[model samples]
Target: MSTTRTILICSGKGGVGKTTTTANLGIALARQGAKTVVLDADFGLRNLDLLLGLENRIVYTAQEVLAETCRLEQALVKHKQEPNLALLPAGNPRMLEWLKPKDMQAIVALLERQFDYVLIDCPAGIEDGFKNAAAAAREAVVITTPEVAAVRDADRVIGLLNTQGVQPVQLVLNRVRPKMMSNQEMLSVDDVTDILALPLLGLVFEDEQVIVSTNRGEPLTLSDSSSPAAQAYGNIAQRLQGEDIPLMDPSQARRGLRARMRKLMQTRIF
Candidate 1:
């Protein structure tokens, strides 16, 4: 089993695919035969379990274990296909604030023995909830889109991670539309990397399949097929394992008809 057991997925702002990235990365690692557990720390928002299609089966929660009402094993909700992957849901918002940080640390230490990787899906925003989510994590994955707002928030999160002594806060640039970047209308992968100044973990293209999968409560990394986003997530899992996997350049990823036309137009403009 790998010694580095916990990875926290965090972001300073909302609508930047933090939870989706968390869910799919768990899917990726588990498929590789790692014993993985995705812990939703989203508090009130609580969408991680839904994204995995395990909402109805969540009888026990992290709160239950904290309250000493159930064993952590009893609280684990197993994934349908992957026996190696499990989920420990964050309880509802109203009661989450009451969960002490010491209890959380104790639980994480206990869980580290049972799994190879423990991914904590942190809530958006840097509040008490975010502090609790990142408290015991040694490593982190900070996800953001190519938008300026998301990029800016990611920088702030990176700064906070450093302040907390969290080393190697990796970045994932998601939903990057290639055409707009060439036209100089949107933030490119380079633009985001330059601004955030963190080690690049993965870059996921704007994919229609991502939306469809999310709406259906299915994570993108489950199937064998490789969409732009799915492949990026898979690569991220390998990177987390300390493997050197080359990232797919976002511009190189979108090689469809639309991107071809946009590339031609840009060449003509120059």
Candidate 2:
């Protein structure tokens, strides 16, 4: 199949679940028969392999290609769980300068020739690793948790994406607790979308399953079934396929307007 899409999952701050989003979205896309790949561009701090349960199997990473030890295709590890999905791990112990922007373009350009979609897992912070990931993808997904720090960083990343001429900065709000949001205690969907001024790809509620799944090196999207967060990510995958999937409302656990209005005020005054 011809590749026509590339998505870079990025965050200006750390601990915002960019890797997790990249992995699961790739799974979701692959599930829909889209030949997909998640490139771990977080050189020297790679974790997409571990997140996808392919850590131990990664012998040749992206670093190998940049170091001239192997070709780009030589480093890819097919997902143990996702038949249609594959992963390209990051740096190697001997290769520290693996974050070069051209290497990323070369690798992703090669991937685009074979896969339908390539999702890049960007490193945290606006540094060399981040630039490498941005150079590989034509579009971007800014992942942020509904917290002060993550949101601030996400805003900065969105600005950078725009500056790069990356039209359409998509937002993925992760780890949201609607109960707190409704209580006017946390940031709501509106709060984040308004500040970033971007289209929302998904809203992942704070789910215990996510942490549990991550620890097992599995993405929640695989067996999301009735899980709200899983369902949200799945819908996001469908959207990427050019389908107009309707957004699902978070469970009462997500709360209602009284809480949303409260969240609005809390964010405004802060």
Candidate 3:
């Protein structure tokens, strides 16, 4: 039997790629032979279904499951590209009036029985929606960007998670611009990690292909996606599966051979 693990993917603010991370991670996990289900826990403002390209196929939303109008299995929209992956999309905002933390927990408990991983795409902010998203999560992955405001908000969310007894809140830094970091205009990985003080999950640089893939409603973790963001998401999924993979360092990749050699020589023992 697969021991289901629930992970809530959250951000302190919006536009930090929280849903993007959840979508890609789900696809990656599915590719790795894990049965994964991603929930659009943003409730009234569902976009995960759109991201997974299953918007048209979503005949039954989570609201229907909560209302007992449909079974949970009926509400799951399986990925066309990945059979092992499924999505439980958010429901109507008006119908979500009766949705509570316990309701979320019950849904997660049912999902946990069947899949290896259940990733909840949490809504932005610290409102009731946040609590509902975090309620049944056994773990959390906080998403942030290389900006001051995002980092600060992430820190606040981490504190909230800690107080709520969410164990091992990992950090995934998204939209990292290495050029800005090198120019001292943006927060570096070290800077963000220092401030957040959370275990680093992964890093995704600012890649245009990510936006293109989002617009196309196909996650970049597809078999054909060669974008840097796609590889970062793959790495994160491996790490989540307890694989020891080094985080992507875009700055290192941009360095010239001479610069790399100089740094290597400066740090060499012999």
lDDT (C-alpha, whole model) for all candidates: 0.84, 0.81, 0.89
Candidates 2 and 3 compared: the better one by TM-score is 3
What is candidate 2's lDDT per residue for 1-270, written digit by digit as tens? 554688889988988788888888988899889899888878578788888888888878766666789987778889887789999876674575745788788778778888888888888999777877787779888899888889898988888888888766788888888778877789788888888888888888888887888899989887646777788889889987779987656545555679888878889674
Give the winner by lDDT: 3
Output the better candidate (1/3) by lDDT: 3
Where model 1 places Cα greater than 4 Å from the true spot, the runs are 257-270
* lDDT of residue 162 for candidate 2: 81
Q: What is the Cα-based TM-score of model 1?
A: 0.91
Instruction: List ranges where model 3 is wrong by over 4 Å.
Output: 256-270
Tell me, by TM-score, which candidate is best: 3
lDDT: worst 10-residue window of model 3: 89-98
- Considering TM-score, which of the candidate structures 1 and 2 is the better prediction for this target? 1
Rank order (by TM-score, best first): 3, 1, 2
How accurate locally is residue 214 in candidate 2, as Cα lDDT from 0 to 100?
88
The CA lDDT at 32 in model 3 is 95
